[model samples]
Target: MILDLNQFVSKERPYWDELTAVLKKQEEQPDWKMSLPEARRFHYLYQRASSDLVKLKTFAGEVEVAQFLENLVARSYSRLHEKRGSTIPFRPVHWFLRVFPSTFRRHWIAFMISLFSFLIGGLFGAGVMKFAPQHKTSFIGSFSHLSGKPSDRVAKEEKKQFDGFERRNTFSAQLMANNIRVTILAMVVGVFFGIFTVFLLFYNGIILGVVVFDYIADGQGVFLTGWLLPHGSVEIPAIILGGQAGLIIAHAMFGWGTNLRLAQRFRRIRSDLLTIVGGAALMLVWAGLVESFLSQYHGPTVYPIKIAFGVLQLIALICFLLFAGRTRQPDSIHAG
Candidate 1:
């Protein structure tokens, strides 16, 4: 299995035969498999090799598949030194990571995993939050309550601010940051038996799932979701992502894969999680602002304004994400 192979044979001959063989077999795998480790391996290899493959597949001057044979030869030689711990003059992984998001999209499992966690956790969290006593005390550890403020203070203030929202809406950099924050909170809450993340999700979920309930509870659901929708849509995803990041850490700590390498995996993953957390923080402020000022201030007459702004933010988000793949590598290296 090329998955079992590390790199190429040597600089003179990368592992083309093995890689090609594996790619051929990999092409037959279910679409979801494209996200798995084996599929990832192929993606990595093929992406590097694609330029040559394209030549053979298309723009050849009536050249045969043998024209693509160079990659095989180059890869074979590259694998030689790679396996032996010698320099194969191979391209660095960072080079390809620049395209990782688009490249990794073929691996739909990651998204499915993320969304599945969001749905299950969000609903579960919502149910527990909606029905559970809001004033109950924990049996262990320390409680971090609001200082000199009622539990409802933050929410009420948030509502007040929403009723008076305004901002120089840029590229929804605020929303991106919001995505990062919600995702982080979701993850950080995992530190408490993951119940916290669940509750957090549940809190938001019920708040989201039953807007009518919120309106009924205080005649504020419409305003809440609306103000929230301006940024909640962005902020919530970030928090969910944060929660997912937390779960990843928890799993690594618990030796999800194996005991021998659990710590090693944690070490490997810590930075990635932190980046996710930081990104989450950035998203929250933006989303929070939308909730605080713009969304709330826009009355029924402001519905059109909200729609127009929301669409703009949505478009801006897609554009930023499109560029994120390119940015990820540079950011990661700087992070490292």
Candidate 2:
């Protein structure tokens, strides 16, 4: 049956106002969770209100129409209402541009702000490198030496990350899946794990910082760059971006409200979060290709190795500019 508007509007105005506020929030900004009852409530409320507003506009006294419109508008905002659905039928260009400045801004901005943590993570990673191996060595000495040795047959079979080969030595599927896995880890862990993402990033940074120190200390810093830069340039940044997304959810939790309403807020943020997560996935794809092909090709030298790294990194950068930059060619844009 068609729902009766009078049954809805005849209710006391103040109570309606409160419910309206919650509903508006759902419309404006959905929550970031699996469930979104608050948003659903707003959807139903707005649909009803829109109907009532039209009815009052048509037949009700002028005073009543104004009141009805006022109530409809009020419900939209009291819950921090934002646009949940497309106002018009379609806005492809608008959506394409949407994730750039709005939803994903926090990912980049958070990184800039968290630069201090990066330095700290590096320091700790270095510390772990210096201290942890020493403690484990006595018991692990034989295994450690064995551990360092490449089990070529097993290594190739598993594409064990420890064998220190990337794309050049490994197969494409291994490269792609592993690279994507790390990128996905960054986003998924952050979203599900919340502030724990800080630890994840920090831990990785620390491990990396220490590794760099070890390589430079051994006068193999150049070699290290050759090994890492090709895939890592893409992989590391993607992971950090994922962590930033997690932070957004954590921040949302800081606000006060009912569980239903919070779910609504998350629902609103999902589209934007996907942009960051998707970017992470893309980076992983690039990393896999670089690791599987170039990284496996040359061993330990800048010319054959690092040279390849520099060239590929540059190509990736150029690709990014052409695709995302304003001056991209029409044909390329279409191709992209």
Report the Cα lDDT for residue 104, model 1: 29
**Candidate 2: tens digits of C-alpha lDDT, residues 189-276:** 5545355667667766765676666556556555566667777777666666666666666555553354546678778667667776
List model 1 lDDT by residue over 1-336, tens digit each.
121111222331364555767645534652323346864676566555655454444544333343556645465345423433333564434423333334323323433455565576455544443576252222111323322133253355445434222444543455445455557667766656466665666555543443333233554544444455677666665566566566666666666557568568768767556655555565577676675556546455566677667767867765654554653345444453
User: Which candidate leads in TM-score?
Assistant: 2
Worst window of 10 by summed lDDT in candidate 1: 1-10
Score candidate 2 by TM-score against the native. Answer: 0.53
Error of model 2, residue 186, in angstroms? 3.2
Task: Give per-candidate clash totals.
Answer: 47, 33
After superposition of all CA atoms, the RMSD between model 1 and the true structure is 18.6
Query: Which regions in candidate 1 have their CA more than 4 angstroms from the true location?
Result: 1-185, 189-195, 212-225, 258-260, 326-336
